[model samples]
Target: MDFAFSEEQEMLRSQARSFVTDRFGAERVAQLAETEAGWDESSWDAMTELGWMGLSIPEEQGGAGFGFLEEAVLFEELGYGLYPGPYFSTVALARRALDGAPEQLKRLASGGSRLTLAWIEGGRAKLLPETGMSTQAQESGDGWTLTGEKHLVPDASAATDVVVVAAGPEGLGLWVARCEDAKIEMDPTMDRTRRLGRIIFDGTPAEQVAGAGDVRSTLERVQMTAYAALALEAVGAGQAAFELAADHVKTREQFGKPIGAYQAVSHQVVDSYIGIELARSLAYWAAWCVAEGDERAPMAAAAAKSFAGEAAVASCERAIQVHGGIGFTYEHPLHRYYKRAQWIDSFDGFGSVQRASVATALLGS
Candidate 1:
């Protein structure tokens, strides 16, 4: 299927790129990473004013009423910019995870609240298990009490709310809880731009949402959407790294000529460029499948995620190699991009897990 962006979508991309270039440059991102919140209030407010948080939300739910495709366009630009904020956790993960909760959806669309997901437990990152979930939810008066710890929850400290998946007497369910009510400890990670948290819940109050579908099915659907969004983000990062390397090779002199003039350097750059393009195509296709609710979305998302992640990492590595020792230094911005790509590639399901998912879809589970 053709995944060409509409004229309006292209315009959005242009606008987003301009915004990122002006407001979210590497310097700005680095500055934000040094802050306590790891983001700028003004920048986030500007994004909210632009209706980005509501881009994929339905109109009836108090959003701009755009589809996932438009959101994907914005996500790629955000990735390229290396945006440091909870936008990914709020929109890409929480919004998609809690679609059945209209009131919370409205709050998110309006930028009145920020929510993140807490699902991975005890180093289990591949899939949400049907059983043996450490977090347990017990029925309380008019609500539920969640108990246990969640590992590596993105933006937990920054979010106002958290969507926690826990096992209950009725099986697993999605529960919404106040972030303040839980013990949130930020973990030191390679990607300081995007914060991760270790969240512990001891008799924390929560309200269940998304009750129509089976819990595993709902979680799987959320994961598919996340995979597509993350793939596109990785593609953007890869593109940025490639651009940086391409520009560097053309300018940095060696033997009184540009280093890019050498076939050894030029060939590597060309290979990276080709990989980014391929990853971009697959990522966009996966986004399209998700937007259309196509039956093949699972397979498409897995394949796109698996390939895009590797492509992005390879691009970062090649960029470093081409830049020589400077790229390895902390002062250079290339390392930041590399760290961000590595973090995203491992979040939730890594490349190997995604590839296994694709294999299962193609070969028979």
Candidate 2:
């Protein structure tokens, strides 16, 4: 299939880039990171007002009526700016899960409610935790009661509702449960920018909508959404790191010449350039798959996430390397980009996991 983004998609990309650039420059993002909340409320509100938070929502639900490709572009801009918020967890995975939940679409689309997916368990990384969840989704007169614990729920401390992926008597349905009633507790994280919470649901109220089909089938769809958003975010962060490094190389001097003149530094900068462009291609393509409703979106998103996530991490590392001793310090912006990329890698298995997923797709189970 042809991989070019249509003019309309390009327009959307430009608009989103402009919005993020104007809203969260290096200084401003740094400023926001220092706050107790570690997220920029003003910028988050601006994104919601611009319909970015619900870009994929249908117009009937008071959204932009756009599709996934457009959303991918916006997310790349967020990554580029390192826009701190629950944009990834709240907008990407939670929204899709809620779409399958009974009567939750209206609340979610209106931004009157927000949700986070809780799948992370303790000390598990580099791959999805295989530990069986303990959540009980037993039938009730009204609906269902969810009782269990989910650790490392992004933004759950402030969410209105949470989409709990649990084993139910019938099958796996994205169970929607009230957040305030769930007895969630916040925990400190390495990033310290995005809040993490551990939630305990003691017969908490829930509404379950059986997925379009089986549990695994529904989860693939959910993962595609997450992978696509991470790809876009990678594109943003990689490009930002490259820009910062490039400017520094031109201005910083060594041996009576700008560092850009040195082959050692110039080559790394060029590599970063290539990495960003390659990652960008994969991200946009994955986004197109989602918008066009192609069945191959899962694989496409995996490819994009793997490549872009790696590229972002590598680019930030090179940025710090090129910045000399100052890059190692906490005061440098390179560290910020570096930490962001590390979080992305740790949270979503690095490109290695995607590579394995791709291999599985090609070779079959």
- Considering every candidate listed, which one attains the maximal TM-score? 1
lDDT of 1 by residue, 171-230 (tens): 778899998899999998788888898999999999898442567777788888888888
Q: Which candidate achieves the best lDDT against the true structure? A: 1
Measured with C-alpha atoms, the lDDT of residue 200 in candidate 2 is 92
Candidate 2 TM-score to native: 0.91
- 246 in model 1: Cα distance from truth in Å? 0.4
Query: What lDDT would each prediction earn against the true structure?
Result: 0.87, 0.77
Candidate 1 Cα misplacement greater than 4 A, ranges: 211-213
lDDT of 2: 0.77
Q: What would the per-residue lDDT of candidate 2 be over residues 1-365, giving only the tens digit for each residue?
A: 67777798788778877876787777777887777767665655667776776677777767777778777777887788787777787878777665554356666666677678876554542123354455668888968898778887877765777877776776555587878888978887665556688999889888875542555655666788888888888888889999999999999998899999999999999999999999999888888886686888889989999998889999999999999999898887778888777777655667788888899999986
